[model samples]
Target: MTLYARYSELLDTVLDTLQADGTLPDGIERRAVAVEPPRDPAHGDLATNAAMVLAKQARTNPRALAEAIAPGLEALPDVSSVEIAGPGFINLRLTDDAWRGELATILREGDSYGRSDAGGNERVNIEYVSANPTGPLHLGHCRGAVVGDALARVLEAAGFRVTKEYYVNDAGGQVDTLARSVHLRYREALGADIGEIPEGMYPGDYLVPIGTSLAAEFGDEYAEAPESEWLELFRTRAVAAMLDFIRHDLATLGIHHDVFASEAALQAEGAVDAGLERLRSKGLIYEGVLEAPKGQTPEDWEPVELTLFKSTEFGDDQDRPMKKSDGSWTYFGSDAAYHLRKAESADHLVNIWGADHAGTVKRVQSAVKALTDGRVDLDVKLVQMVRLFRAGEPVKMSKRGGTFVTLADMVEEVGKDVVRFIMLTRRADAPLDFDFAKVVEASKDNPVFYVQYAHARVRSLVRKAADAGVSLDAPADLSLLDAEELALVKLAAQYPRTVESAAMAHEPHRIAFYLYDLAAAFHALWNRGNDDPGRRFLVDDNPELSRARLELALGIGQIIRSGLDLMGVEAAEEMR
Candidate 1:
């Protein structure tokens, strides 16, 4: 029922014909061959990379291979023409009927048009926005969270078994600092006048709830104890409180993770030790000293011996230390083991990280390679900065003094839907500018509102059509649809193919852009009707044309619904 996907079957048929006709070399691998939209629309509706991919292995000129592939394709029903352009790309132009038939499929499949099985139920783990438990998530974490969540949704739509995960940095110096901050709050909760927060203590008032709860539960007993007595327990309580607040903030944007892996748990059962031993068996662990890292050489850059992981054995610039001189594991040490643990259960691993950790990419990937010995694929997506704005003015930050905005604060101001949709309007690696004023406007400039408006418009069209007594026969004549009506139908048919591409490329922003384009096309068609009375969705005494156009509009509406669902944006039947 998926129009674009069905063409892939036709593509397979062409390959089979080539093999059977003895035109192509024997033992051709079909898996490497792909069908996609040509970058230049003038080339064709779709282009395949098969010719170039098979050229080296088959020992044949790519153009000749493309020539052989074209004849087989030209014989297909939907393929109007197949041309070999520049190198060996095979371009296919579908017939008008072929494009028109896509609308039929949209009505049949509804919102599920673009779902693909490219993943074949394989297990995929996506770790993202593993922000520290120290404070509320802010604009820094927003883009990665939206990107990761949307990517998981797209992958699942493509038939992959995806697990959304959050790695909590609970057992670390940050958490210890968090404990000290709460101890201050605990003292304040007992009505003590705590002076200005110490230089090293966390200054956020977020931990006040933890203190108030402690006083209510354990009473003055724990309050009277020394710092050591309540620090760990308070740290645990504060982290739980922080996580709950974080999860609630994420839910506002409809984000959810299947797993919440704690770094402490990896250390609890000696999993970190076990992971290091596995690397040791592979001759990838040793005790040594590392050279000074890039940029500033720490004043304490004395060449000191420590147990180091042989990340250099894979691709790291230098051996990285697993333990500092004092015997405590460094952040990189826990991260290496964490990835190893993930690699064990996934066919593929994807981690979404903040821009600040760009340097950590090589070490984590190296550890993953060491653990899986290159069997598992690991991809780390680094998110660039977000330039938060409101009506063209830059938003300032330094929220420790209340200068910046928190994630919850943004959601509270703009609402969750606007915040999520605007975040995805740009790629994760590219810098994104989120404007609070622009995103919530009802005008066409707001992509989120524009796309949602298309849905609401279509929904209203369907209800009006029914009220006008339009009845669709058992099988309407699709060929009778006008050119404008047919064009909208063709757009509806491409939903499935778009989903497949977005997932395969690991690009969720593509979905956002695609939905905007689809919405634009549909809206343009609607406005055309308004400009020409005869072509309007509701024409006077032209029941047949109106019925035909209504069906086309319905198909477009269904596709818009499907695309918005994939992007985790609501397909509003009506907008506020």
Candidate 2:
């Protein structure tokens, strides 16, 4: 167990003892009590607000309650001291043996050091990068892909049964455009002069190979077929090819999905109609005319009666229409059916979308709530825009002009590790600037390089110890470690808590930030040796001390590796 968890368990034991002795009231809810790292390290190793939380309920003075609880915590085996501070907070300083035991646990657990059961084996479905099956994935789709994939890994480490999912929007009008583009290419391949891909058709050269494959399969067979006869055939082939291209792009960035749910297949199976009927049976669906949107009204806007869902009853700003004026199902209708199908099996649903879809979140959430009857919970994370730069100048990319930077392009320019790590330097809701010049620099400004450098430095230390014949089999004399060394261990000890918190919050960026902090701590210790020879890991006259220090270094390396694995990043053994 992590030291923080151990301390929390001790605090709980104290609370139980207080209640049993009648000093505290029985059945006092302890859920709000938190044992966490103190805001100021000078205060203590850990701090708790148990006294403040229970004082009112127990009908006692806050500081007096803290004073009463302090003795019980101070008497615990692992706690070295406990002090009651301002406003009923209790600060704790743990024994050196406690930090040593945590290091031993780290060496024993290795890559599984931070794994936890906080999720309690709940099933979570994460759906992301559901881009339209039109062309190659562009910069717009990159952040959500990386964020969703990393969050899945984080939740898995926190003991959730996670399913990584991708939704294929193949039933949309964009796919029809893809089919037409492919047909144009097919005609061009058959010696027909299909002029400059007329406006509104995909013009990326990535489709040239698909056109060649089509020509090879049926010589002029589809070249002459009318629109009705060839639309479905071309649509099927185009979507399949685009999905393969998308899969390859995702592979380059080290992303894989367990399920790829198809909107077209759901619509084909009458799932949308059945879902609507279920809502209709519950009187949640009605035919109504919606008011004009509040902002600038479209010139073509006109009131029309359509099938609407009673989304406003569930906190949406207004009732949402489920069908278009032409009587065809809308995108929200298809997504509602898709979510209903997902909610049937999963206890939790998470969708990662771009910020452009922010306005649709409430209606989609309302739809899921109505469909599932509050049985399953849904969370939608919106990833903001990413602007790519080389040096300081902006990299202009556009999918319409066929000049957009694709995911494959970025991965090729920089390595997959660089792409993944830099994408997570900021939170999902914050705009990120990926500068080619800065991310590759060997400086602290480049988080990936800084963290990887720390890992590589530890590996180098281990090799030096091995070369000097330092025996690692001996148990470490952790008591010899001073304040600086213990500070490093304290930072490493926060890994499990960070994992649990990041997983619960559905934010994978926290793991990235934690790893960077750990790397900084490790680097600080390494740099300290330069000024004080005794602080160095290698000592000519004291092999025992050298071995102990090496053990500490190895434990830190283990944490870096574990945290990197959670982010789907590689821990480098050597820097290039």
Candidate 3:
């Protein structure tokens, strides 16, 4: 158990005791009670709202309830003091030995220190970076990819069976456009001087290789044939080739999905029909005409009777169309079918989509709820766009990708670690500026560098300690660590709690944010050592103190490495 969790259990025992002894009434809901470090460190090591949450149920004022509860907490081992302050909030102060023992726990657990079973091994299917196979992945997909991948890692660490998934929209019209685009490139490869790509066609040169390969394989067989003869053939081959390209791009960023659910395959198996039938059995599927969209002129809006799903019954703003008047499945219909397929295998489903799809979230969620009969839940995380910049100027589009900077270009320009780390420096729904110059800058302002530097400095310190004849295997007295060093240990001890909360919240960015703060704290301690030699981690004249401090430094390094691993980033031993 984490330090916070241990205290939380003890706090729960205290509350239970209060009820059993008649100091507080029974059957009070303690779910709202939380045990966490105080907002200001000066106040306490840990704080709980047990008294505040239970006072009304106990038929007593919060302050009186807190006073009745304080005695139980004060009796716990390692809890040196417990103070009730400000409207009955209980603040706890533990002995310095508690923080030192946490550091020892860090070293003992090492890389596995923050692992938790909070998820109870529930199955989670996370679909992310499901970009169309028409082109290379862009910066927008990059952000979602990192966020999704990192969340999967965090969830796994928190004991969830997570399936990293990608949905291929190959059944859409976009792939047909891709076929026409590839055909143009094929014709050009076969010696046609195709100048200036058409406005509606993809103009990127990345398709040139696919066309050249097709020309070599089939010669002129489909070159002069009609569109019908080669459209399916080209679409199949082009999507496959583009998928290869996308896989390579994702590999550069260290992303690999365990499952790639294809829309074409789903339709081929009649999943859409089956999904709609399931909803129909529940009376959710109906044929109706939707009212004209908001602000539409009555004459301009011609309502057509379409097959619809009663999404509003499940909390959507309106019923969603499952099929067009001509019987073609709507995007929502196929998407809902895909979700049903996932929910069949997984206990929960999560979709990481661009912010542009925000309006569609509710309908998809409703579909999942209706399809699963509330047995499963769908969590859609919308990631906003990323703006690329060089220094302070906006970066231009990629010639190879045609419209925007490709994920490959960004990964190649900087590195996989930098790309992954910086992409998660903000919340998924917030706009991120991928400043090429700023991310690579070796300064505190750059979170990637700052966090990596903290790890690297610890490595350098260890090497320097070894070179100075300090015995690394020596068991040191942890009591030698001072208040500032113990404070860093306190910060490091929160990793497990952070992992649990981040996993439960489905927010991997919390890990990144926590890592940066931990790094900042470590860096602040390092800076202090420069001014006071006695405070330095390596004290050449005092080997005993150095060994104790070395233990502290190594514990910090272990946390940095573990946290970076969760983010799919490397703990750098040396920075260039």
Candidate 4:
């Protein structure tokens, strides 16, 4: 358990004592009680709102309830003093030994320091980066990929059984266009002058290899055949080839999904029909003409009867369609079915989609809730776009990607670690500016370099300590650490809570924000030695103090490595 968790348990015991002695009421819910660091460090090490939240239930004012709880808290061995400030908030200053014990725990746990079982091994299925197979993954898909993958890592660290998934939209109209585009390329490969790529086809040259392979395999058998003879065959081959291309690009950035569910396979096996039938049995599906979109008159709109799902009953703005007038499933219908299939195996479902899909979130969420009879919940995280720049100038589109900068392009230029770390520097729903010159720059403004440099400095301290004959292998007397050094331990000890909170909120960007603050504190300590030689991590006269300081530095480095591992970034040991 972490220092904070240990104290939280103690606070619970104190509350229990109050109830046992008839000072407070019995059977009151204590779930609202929280023990955390005070807003201001000067207030105290820890503060709790047990009185503030329980005052009403206790039939007393907050101050009166606080008066009853203070003595119980003061009796704890680790607490040196307890003060009630402003509106009956109870703050406690822990003994220095308490902080020292936490530092020792950091060294003892090492890489496993921040890991926890807060998730209780619940099954969570996260589907992300399900880009269409028509082209390479662009910058729009990159942000969602990083956010989803990092979230998976964080959830696993918090003890959830996570399944990383990718949904292939191979059964869509775009893949048909892809087949036509590849057929044109195949004709060009067969010594035919197909001229420039037409207006409606994929214009990138990435498909040239797939066409060439088809020409080399089948010769001219399908070259002169009609579209009916080879459209499905070519679409199958083209989508498979594009999936391979996508997998290679995703692997470059260290992303690999555990499950790749195919929309085409789902439809081929009649899952969509089965899912719709289940909804029909629940009275959520029916053949009805949707009213004209809001703000339009009935005379101006042509309404057609279609198979619709009662999405509005479950909180959606309007009912959603399951099939078109032509009796084919709409995109939302297929997606809803896919979610139903996923929910059958997992306890919870999460979708990471681009911001462009924000309008569809409510409908899909309602579909999941209705389909599962309120048994499962769906969380949709919408990722904003990433704009690329080169030295402050807007970057031109990639020729290979046809319109946008490809994921492979970004990963190849700035490296995988830099790409992963910088992508998360902002919230996933906020626009991010990525400059080639800025991300690779070795400056404090760059979080990737700043965090990595802190870890590298810790490693450099070890090498310097070895050369100066300062032994670090001996047991560290943590009591030798002063207030300045112990302050760092206080910051590093929040890692466990940080992981648990970030995982619970489904916000992986919190880890990035926390790492930057921790690194800043460490750098401030490293810079302190420049003014006084005695403050240096390696003391020429007092080797014992030097070893204790080294222990502090190593503990910080261990935390940095663990956070970077969760982000899928490497901790640099040395800088060039």
The pairs that clash in candidate 1 are 114-496
lDDT for model 4, on a 0 to 1 scale?
Answer: 0.92
Of 1 and 2, which scores higher on lDDT?
Answer: 2
Task: Please write out the lDDT profile of model 1 over residues 272-361, one tens digit for every residue.
Answer: 888878888988778887776679888867888888888887888888888888988888888878888887788889989988889889
Q: Clash pairs of candidate 4? A: none
lDDT of 4 by residue, 250-309 (tens): 999899999999999999999999989989999999889997877758675788999999
Candidates 2 and 4 compared: the better one by lDDT is 4
Candidate 2 lDDT, 1-576, residue by residue in tens? 666777788889999999999989999999999989998999988999999999999999999999989989989997888888988999998888888888888888888888988889999999999998888888779989999999999999999999899999999899899999999988888889987888999999988888888988998987888899889988999999999999999999999999999999999999999999999998999999999979999999999999999999999999988899998999999989999999988999999999999999999999999999998989999999999899999998777789989999989988899989988889999999999889889999899999999999989998888889887776878777777887888889999999999999999999999999999988888887798888888877788888888888999999898888888899999998
Model 2 / residue 374 / CA error / Å: 1.3
The segments of candidate 4 whose C-alpha lies over 4 angstroms from its true place after superposition are: 296-300, 398-403
Q: Roughly what TM-score does model 4 have, to 2 decimal places?
A: 0.98
On residues 318-353, what C-alpha lDDT tens digit does candidate 3 reach at each position? 999999888888899999999999999999999999
Candidate with the larger TM-score of 1 and 3: 3
Give the 10-residue window scoring lowest on summed lDDT in candidate 2.
1-10
Q: Candidate 4, after superposition: displacement of residue 213 in Å? A: 0.8
